[model samples]
Target: MNCWKTINISRDYGTLRLIMFSSSTVLLSFLFYYLVMSTIVQTTEFTQFGFVTVVLSLFGLVLTHKLLHCLPIWLFGGRAKIKISTRKLLFPLMDIKLREPLSRNVYLLALFSPLVFITTAGAVGSIMWPQFLPYFSILTSINFGLAFYDLVYASHLMKAPKQCYIEDHDEGFHILIKQAV
Candidate 1:
């Protein structure tokens, strides 16, 4: 599959609308962090097993997050795939590709799904295992870090709605926005 595609942004309004739609993810992520982490530091602890668990959970979270973004593309009738660059272990990444163009809203949702899922799950895990809350809190931060790009693209994608993509070619995969019917 081709790793790059140019998104043609033909409308200014669509760009603005996309930006507005994508910014909500950042705002929501912040609100979630505040609501969930307010008292987390004071009440949590870490152990060897907890630390290991947190690391493993983070790996799972990252894979799941990537999968979440791909699901929307599939749901919209496009093919999505992940490819890793073995040469860049220092900055390993996943590349997403899709054939069918989806709506701006669908693309936005795909970007933010990981944040929503990982944060919610981390917060819930903390609550469930109060003694290991610190471990979970650390996992929460890691997941947030993973979502950073999705958040940024969500914003840029909003800005270039007509184009339907916010691609970082050094990375992989670009958002594809379909024309409105």
Candidate 2:
């Protein structure tokens, strides 16, 4: 599919639903990991150098995922920008917007970029270094949980009767419904 016109991003209806969906998914994943996965561990340590490195690298991976989405916008002739700030003790937000509505395929591809990168890399790393499965699994779960929301929102946009409008915001990017006129 293709996007034919410019669209405004909104924090309206569909977005709220996606936020709820994303939140619930993350919460469930965290709970499951804590209650189930954590208990399965046969070994424990307060801190380990290799694990710390893996943790930092995974954080880098997440940032890379965001950059992956942003960088492509410019390459594809769409303008993109980001603003970062924290609202509360735990509320850290990274907002991004593309000035142009990318093709549906591009948008969809971008949505899955993190998942593909994290999961694929983690799978390979885990196989090559079996001892790192715990770290890889933990990081992969986090990225997967987060990407769930974006996938839902992308799906909603793809099904929208109107074109999607994506614009920059002070906090998070807004996805707007295009007017018929």
Candidate 3:
């Protein structure tokens, strides 16, 4: 196999830029989702959870989003190592390292699973329980923010050859293609 390209989005785009993009995504998604849901469900009742509860719930959402990324790979018989650690002694971080490369389609599926699943569930929940729309919208927006990096990685992968394989590395990911004889 030939190494086609190496993509390190954080390095290429800069961590600050990526963080800014993700912050914007969270705010914009929340605004858009809240507006749409509010119109659909004309209820003025908004349930507010406690500050500690909200923080813990958001943390759980982040963990769930990370697990969703691994779900597809697990189903495809791939092995991954998940590391959970704390950043700044407060924020939790989860890193998943793949034991083997995956086909372009499967890798894309893994990258997108969190966004699709969480967003869909949030939408459905908001519609069913309008009073919790704020919470649902916040969770969904946060998921989208977390998925910003995944979306960037997917764009690069999508441009690679369809037969390519994606391998995660400490830097980012390596796109490999089979050599033609």
Q: Model 3: what TM-score?
A: 0.91
In angstroms, how far off is 176's CA in candidate 2? 8.5
Estimate, for each residue in 1-181, the C-alpha lDDT of model 3 and write its tens digit.
3435544433366889999999999999999999998899877778888999999999889889989999999999989878887867866678998999889999999999999999999999998899999999999999999999899998888898898888888767888877644
Total clashes for model 2: 9
The alpha-carbon lDDT assigned to residue 84 of candidate 3 equals: 81
Candidate 1: list runs displaced more than 4 Å: 1-54, 88-92, 162-181
Model 3: how far residue 78 lies from native, Å:
0.8
Q: What is the lDDT of residue 116 in candidate 2?
A: 78
Q: Candidate 2 — what's its lDDT?
A: 0.62
Off by over 4 Å in 2: 1-58, 88-91, 160-181
CA-only RMSD, every prediction: 8.2, 5.9, 2.2
Candidate 2: tens digits of C-alpha lDDT, residues 1-181: 4333444444454767767777677667655654554455443443334767886876676677687667656666777776576977575567676665555545666677777776677666655555555666667667767788667657656765444555445444445544544
Among all candidates shown, the one with the greatest lDDT:
3
- Sort all candidates by lDDT, best to worst: 3, 1, 2
TM-score of each: 0.63, 0.62, 0.91
lDDT score at residue 177, model 1, on the 0-100 scale: 48
